[model samples]
Target: MKPSIEYLQDAIEKLGVENDSKAAAALKISKQAICSYRSGERIMDDFTCIMVAKTLGIDGMEVIAAAQMEREKNEERREIWADFRKKFGVKAGIAGLAAALTLGSLAPSKANASNLELGAISCLESPVKLYIMSNLAWGGFSSKQQKCW
Candidate 1:
């Protein structure tokens, strides 16, 4: 699990808040709570993790699971939380990739329009096309027949 301070810093940076006090206000928490999170004296609660995730535009479950893992005392329960984090993180990544692909396909260029048609056909034909397209879009090698749509 990532440290609470890291999450706090990320929220502060991503929210463009000037200080911990401002971040606390934005997150609807006390400044002292922010200080406790920064000092690792306390892990964020589920609500705070959700707020952080919303601020970061990430999956709330991923952040919640990470916090749960950090707070769990039992090793087995910690592992469960870890598993939840991994699962939700992958789902969130896939959703992000899908959104990017959809946006790219919306470009006004004719070439992109053609790719959009190809992508629609591929989606109808095989779910595996999503995996291939995501890889190619991220700079993976692709054959002419496997071009990312």
Candidate 2:
């Protein structure tokens, strides 16, 4: 897996930002936060990764995959800690395992909106699909008569 730093650098370059501080300004975040994301000290949330992808004119799934890599590494560390706690007692081990499982379950799953099946584009979120349909429904014309397509 390519490091998060590579993705961050590519985004920063694509956005024509001079450095992390400038990139942070463009994204309305702190430079330190950007640095942390690059260093894998913090994982980027889904919406933030999507916004970065949008800003960089790249696919959001790529950013999501990179962030998932970081999250998986962190999850491994958590599993190791849980295993170490197993030596204390069966109850403690079960509790640790349960906590790990709960945290893992909180990660985002694929959206399953039934009415949003647009063939190959079904992978996008339902709201985004709905937004596209709503905008395109007027035959490339907006409510204000603006061209939307």
Assess each prediction's global lDDT (C-alpha) against the native. 0.78, 0.66
Best TM-score among the predictions, by candidate number: 1
What ranges in model 2 sit over 4 Å off?
A: 73-149
Error of 1 at 114 (Å): 16
lDDT of 2 by residue, 8-60 (tens): 67777888977888899887778888988877688887766777878877667
Worst window of 10 by summed lDDT in candidate 2: 80-89
Q: Please state the error at residue 80 of candidate 1 in Å.
A: 1.0
